[model samples]
Target: MIETVIVVLHLLVAIGLVGLVLMQQGKGAETGASFGSGASGTVFGSQGSGTFLSRVTAILATTFFLTSLGLAYYASHKASAVQEAGLPDPALQVEQVAPAPVLSEDVPVIEEDVTPVPAGEDVPPAAE
Candidate 1:
């Protein structure tokens, strides 16, 4: 559930980053133009969109990068909801097992001996 939320946030951040990047002015637009032409001194405007937009873009980029790392961490650590789960590994898996007893073809094992009693007499306990 947390992973899903992070994925959604990551996608939103990526889209925001792309939009911000596209909206910003590219190289050789306004800053260098005012330097080459002395008609105007346009280092920064009253609204200062260049600095503000760039700062926002940088923030979005960082967020996107962090979300990407989070997704990678989740993908590497979490297991799938299937029988044969995410990557074949030992900590997540062991062997398939069943409760089976081993049998051998050699002579059968006996724990105690059995002896026949005398025909019809009550036998007294033998002195040990």
Candidate 2:
């Protein structure tokens, strides 16, 4: 249950991070405003949006990292629990089947006698 919650939270944080990153304007956008493009009007003022968006992005990134680590930990812990319950580890389990006998070159192979017909010959019907 806890792992499920963490996974959901992790996915949400990842999506949010993507959205937040896409919503932020590129560094080149500032250059346009300086050339009198009248791009100075911003919702979070001149410099405030940068700080706020950066801080939010940082927080989301941290959350994403934490959730990633948490999910990894839980997965490993569950695997170990299964191992502790006397189930063999798949990596260590080896079936002791008998190896196949290697064929030697000394073995004789029988070949069938096949005859080829000429290309322009009138073909005869196959015998029953």
Candidate 3:
């Protein structure tokens, strides 16, 4: 549930950033080159300050950065509750890799010989 909420928040922030950027006019827009007004007022009213759109863009951009960082943090952290339910500890999993089979160091392995005999020759003595 937390993962889903984070995913949704991340997506919303991404979309908001895209929208905010698109809504702002470009540098070459005609709002600056018209009716005796220089490129100053059209941009920041000659005070060199950002406009409402600029402020909104900044806020959304910050949200985007924060949400991105949050998603990354959440991704790296495993949920302890989920991991503790009948699940093997990740650390011990590798250690428990079935200790290599221990062979008897003192015993020598011997192979038995198997032979087939001719069918008719001696009807190997019958039990009396």
Q: Which predicted model would earn the best TM-score?
A: 2
Find the candidate with the highest lDDT and give its number: 2
Error of 2 at 50 (Å): 2.1
Q: What is the C-alpha RMSD of each candidate to the true structure, in Å?
A: 21.2, 7.6, 16.8
| Runs with alpha carbons beyond 4 Å of true place in candidate 3 | 30-50, 79-128
Worst 10 residues of 3 by lDDT: 41-50
Question: TM-score for every candidate vs. truth?
Answer: 0.51, 0.63, 0.47
Taking the tens digit of each residue's C-alpha lDDT, what string does model 3 give over 42-117?
4566433336778888887888788788877775566564476767756666554667877797888787664566
After superposition, which runs of candidate 2 have C-alpha atoms over 4 Å from their true positions?
34-41, 90-128
- Which stretches of candidate 1 lie above 4 Å from their native place? 31-48, 79-128
Task: Quantify all predictions' global Cα lDDT against the true fold.
Answer: 0.76, 0.86, 0.71
Candidate 1 lDDT score relative to the true structure: 0.76
Q: List the residue pairs that clash in candidate 2.
A: none
Sorted by lDDT, highest first, which candidate order results?
2, 1, 3
Give each model's clash number: 0, 0, 0
State model 3's lDDT.
0.71
